[model samples]
Target: MVVIKNKCISVSYSDPNFVIVVVAAAAVLLSLCVVPVSAAAAKQELKLRFGRNGEFKILQVADMHYANGKTTPCKDVLPSQVHGCSDLNTTAFLHRIISAEKPHLIVFTGDNIVGLDATDAAKSLNAAFAPATASNIPWVAVLGNHDQESTLSREGIMKHIATLKNSLSQVNPLGAHAIDGFGNYDLEIGGVKGTRFENKSVLNLYFLDSGDYSTVPSIPGYGWIKPSQQFWFERSSAKHRREYMSKPEAQKGPAPGLAYFHIPLPEFASFESTNFTGVRQEGISSASVNSGFFTTLVAAGDVKAVFTGHDHINDFCGELTGIQLCYAGGFGYHAYGKAGWKRRARVVEATLEKTEKGSWGAVKSIKTWKRLDDGHLTAVDGQVLWSKKSSGNRRKKQIPIT
Candidate 1:
């Protein structure tokens, strides 16, 4: 121990009568350098509020499919076509979106990366989420069909993501449930009503792992959300309801929410609404078996819409019953996409009701659209995708947990 200016600094000496302490000091310095820096713990509850103008925007980038290898000709797509996995242009495209949109939150739907080596996969994901992280925007994700196809397992990929700054990704805890997927969790965005101290959640976001392939012997191709996962969703919803809706002053209703995954559900086949605004070339490549996950959402009455990414060429959205079904275009050049097809992303702008002093109104509506890489923007549906009126309920302020 050494005292300087009334401050004591501890120093370890192997010999009690040591005349020279340089070697010990050097060892201490080396130890300090070798120690790993601890990361900030993940949030237990994420908080979000509307902007000054009562609006929040979310940019959804899907099918990034980044890889660390050199660009190669996708023989499956076309003779003249090339994949953009290792192309520098992929980084430029993502940076442009971050600059243009400046979204409050960026959501990567799935297939954010695909690489052979685990280290390369992590590097690719770091590049993919770089835009959002650099802009100080928190990003969340769900696992897709192609995500686990690489050398990295779903848990391993999520663990890598957790190391990133400003990452809000959460996967299923080990041995918690029978669900076969990772990163299945929900988050809520709260809004405060004036200065009266009455605040509550206005929107909920659900991120689920729509698995890559079916485990059943007979079924092939796409995977479906398992019944255990559905049960997990129900339990989560119930807990949220008990936390907020059970309050004496709480409004009696379901909180409006949105679900994002990789593969489209089988029920998306019934999406024949005439309100389609975007393009759809390939048929919906949904799971072979209807897992009733859509039915679970409908019964829960919280999920207002579902967005997916597996079908790269399909970027259209339409009403499936009362809920909206939408697809974001493939954002990666590495993915299997039409040669001339424009790479695009989906933008969801939520409109919060303008509330008077001392009182708050629910979410007025949510408008969704697609923005192509060329900067062109158009609504997913010509009409409003989801309105408070259409939902038959208004989401009131969720009381802040004091």
Candidate 2:
């Protein structure tokens, strides 16, 4: 007698194990259709490299505001005043940026996740870094005011983040400087071959945590960098200069570096006074207390640019004392941002060039611009924001003299 079961037709009495044979055949066919996951499923680290043309592009994704589990409906979000009621599609948005820009390194400036338990927050953060790791790109981040709001402390959150493959954050080991926050660190990006700046780091990247809401009643808005952290920055920059640029008389300038943090500094107020460019829709939501961090940066003369996230609606770049201060705009649907303003990010492009005065290799010019999620682009302040020439030298090459 003939029998049919699902897709297999066989003789019912032909053999006792005829049914088993049909099942086995089906298993084999099923295995053929199953897709094997990529080896990247096992976490891996990637070494960051400069571009072939000695250019390095950094994609800054700010205020991701990723929330764990299903996205909260816009109307259900708390306070009833929050903007952008759409669902928080964090991974999809990040994937789009990673695929389009193909940045060598991605910097999450702040507020990566909000309003979730530690486990969910960790998973949310892991999703943020997944785009970088799967593409073999190195990424780093700093904490925003809301990062530790719900169930995680800054230290607790950072411990989980450090486990992510290709992440550059670590538990602060600088003794006293480790206080209050985590991931206060610096990195050096070396130059490439055939480039004028082959031997040394053409650029330095500084990462610092701009802490959450003030625990003190006297202080307002958000937290500020403590004196100890500023001391660390001064010491670190001085050490880098003394070791790399100062010793070699031929190498004329301090290695050009940029600082990344979550909140804006009080000095960001200077942008209002000066004839600044870019969209300054909202007022600067900086710390009430001036930490003098900006003064230290100006004195060190190494950090020529600073990028921040936090004020989600404002995406602008302005010059202050020859240094370029800019915002990475807001990219999260969970966070409060203007409804009309499209989600956006900041792209910083740096090139190593031969300096006529100092050592042949130094960051020539840093040009930054904004990119909206819909593919529209806006140059900083209506023009391409360019960095000043190497001012670490005494030569008269017309670099912005900060």
TM-score of each: 0.79, 0.76
Clash totals in order: 7, 2
lDDT of 1 by residue, 194-221 (tens): 5221355677788888887776666667
Best by TM-score: 1
* lDDT at position 131, candidate 2: 69
**Which segments of model 2 are wrong by more than 4 Å?**
1-49, 74-88, 116-119, 173-178, 193-199, 246-249, 354-360, 375-402
Clashes of 1: 7
On the 0 to 100 scale, the lDDT of residue 209 in model 1 is 83
Model 1 lowest lDDT segment of ten: 1-10
Question: What CA root-mean-square deviation does each model show from the true structure?
Answer: 15.4, 19.9
> On residues 251-324, what C-alpha lDDT tens digit does candidate 2 reach at each position?
66677789999999987777663355457778899988776788889899888789999988877776677676
Q: Give the best candidate by lDDT.
A: 1
